[model samples]
Target: MSSETKSPTPSAGLKSNLPSTTTFITGHNAEGKAIVLDSRPATWKSFENGVMGFNQIYTNPFPPDLNGDADLHFHDDKIASGNLGLAVKNGTVCRMVDFGPGYVCMMHRTQSLDFGIVVEGKIDLVLDDGSSTHMKRGDIAVQRATMHSWRNPSTTDWARMLFVLQDARPLFVDGVRFGEDYGRGTEGLPRSGNDD
Candidate 1:
């Protein structure tokens, strides 16, 4: 990653008001005993004019190969390359997102099954049909290739969400395939599965 894009410690980000996130990665030692491979605050990337930020926790190709800790190497490569997009083809990505106060994300969709959990504050999940649902801490939203947007209703506090996105077959609704849609919110970022 370029120095400009490299993330500083969690306390140095645009969303400093939000609490930092610590990630724990486990692996097996040479003796085959489980060990703590890594435990530290996650790296974050602030975007959308600093109104939104993403902390990429981990990623691995589907049917991950853990032997020799190859998956860990893969994740390190992704970070070093600084091309971890919204989704990985035939893989899974665990990320944490911070929404600035009163921020509303653009409507978009990805070809993945996402499990989004509200970790702090409240948010509204708005669907393409104009329907929405209010969610608070501890609430989880199971998104199956749906066109949606997220809105943080708070005007003074930031909201945090942890999402696990797993690649899925392209959604076919009425014979129409809905591929990855970055929409307006994601401009510089590549589309899903295009990190390379």
Candidate 2:
């Protein structure tokens, strides 16, 4: 059982109260035997000047080719290269995000379907139309391709959420195509190739 561990380090000017998240990858060994491949903590990348941290847990292209462990090698390469982006153009990505106390993310839109699940603390999901919904632990927000943002309402504790994003068909409303809008959170992250 091969393992790769990365200890979580708090970013400068921010201290997160959330614990580290560990991920386990399973695969088949030689002779067609199932086995645990890798188990380790997902590496976190600080963003918004330490107001937020993101960890890419796993990603794979749509219609994944699992034969011969090709997908496993692909994921390994992505981790080694450290080029995992916010969303995959023709794939799916699972990510975990930590929000600092009272941090409000910029209003942005992605051309993908997202399942955002609140894992810790409380958060407010704000929409472009000025409507907000308070989500507590175990609440899930199925975010379609829309303009939205996340706000951590607690001023003394951090919040965490897990998001599963899948590439979606181009979204058009009133003949206006809305692509990816990273807003103020574009630093150190690559576009998901859905931009218009």
Candidate 3:
């Protein structure tokens, strides 16, 4: 057959379904109303498509005096170091993360230890003792198993955070219980806005 004599039929259809992907419902609004699933919640498999999620679980029990709000968010798709799920190796683990604008996250515990570092943007860490810390870029705090909450102060900006969580333990330390109290160890330590 001549080179130009024949041609294959051209396929015509939607070539990409990425941007138009379906949203999966997983939560609700602050008013206890049905929440539209804006995006998929972060899971171990989230790293597969260069898109991870870290959002407030609106389905869980709402914190006292508060409604459903996702002040903290995390988007981590790249594996910075080690193999996938490497965190389970040491029996103790740490995770560093980056949050985009409209991002917020936690660094304290109601049931476990939480730690965080703010490399950019502003955030507020609220403690169970009615005390709170307002942190800006380059600030960090570690929670040794204390009840706490995380909030984002900016309306248009996203805060990037580096979180380090330790494996759960029966006790905060020998003879020291972190079950229902924390943040009192900061009497001598500089707090947020300390410029440290």
Candidate 4:
């Protein structure tokens, strides 16, 4: 169990079976034309253990940099936040995640409202209050910055889910604002970067 372990890199012929693709569009040259920025296949970063799901297929560094009026308006792939999710303050993120059989993410919470859709297979959404719901394909879930976790109960099948995370105001209770809690080091289990 070494923290120095490296994650799996995608090869030339290795394509993920997940059906997720992102099409980026941006403004063009002085002619004021609309152009396609990058229309390549979606990239997947496999987990080091090969059992965890993939995270952050694409990221827009600045969510507020929507207009091309800023000094830098493009995405930067080199910025790594260590947390696999691409959520940013006052911005939005689009990501596709997959969970293999018997995989259960630890309970965690972020300051974002997540809109998730079960694209393939089935998964159980467990809440902080111990309430759990079984979600299947075509099911849409709206998570409102609440503590939760995902569990894939299937023994032989994988579950693919698409999520759109939008930065939101921090949850306030009793006049105290609590920030995000990733809740690492649970159950003596190792931390997985794909927890989102």
TM-score of each: 0.90, 0.89, 0.40, 0.71
Badly placed stretches (over 4 Å) of model 4 are 1-33, 61-63, 67-74, 77-86, 185-196
Candidate 4 TM-score to native? 0.71
Q: Each prediction's Cα lDDT score?
A: 0.83, 0.83, 0.41, 0.63
Q: What's the candidate order when arranged by decreasing TM-score? A: 1, 2, 4, 3
- The pairs that clash in candidate 1 are none
Model 2, which residues run further than 4 Å from truth? Answer: 1-14, 79-82
**Model 1 lDDT tens row, 1-196:** 1112233465334654776767777777679887777675767788777788888888999899988779988988987887777888889999999999999998988889999999999999999999989999999999998999999999999999999999997677899888888788566786667322
> Model 2, 1-196: lDDT tens per residue?
4755456544444457687778877788777787777776657777767888887787888878888777777767776786766778788888899999999998998999999999999999999999999999999999998899999999899999999999999988999988888887477677787554
Model 3's lDDT to the true fold?
Answer: 0.41
Writing each residue's lDDT as its tens digit, candidate 3 over 1-196 gives 1112223222122121122212244445557676453543222222212222222121211121222333112112112221323122112334434333443343334333456787666778877687879988788887765667667677666454556544444454677665432233223322211011
Candidate 2: minimum summed lDDT over ten consecutive residues — where? Answer: 5-14
RMSD of 4: 7.8
Error of 3 at 189 (Å): 33
Off by over 4 Å in 3: 1-52, 55-90, 96-113, 172-196
Report the number of clashing residue pairs per model: 0, 0, 7, 0
lDDT of 4: 0.63
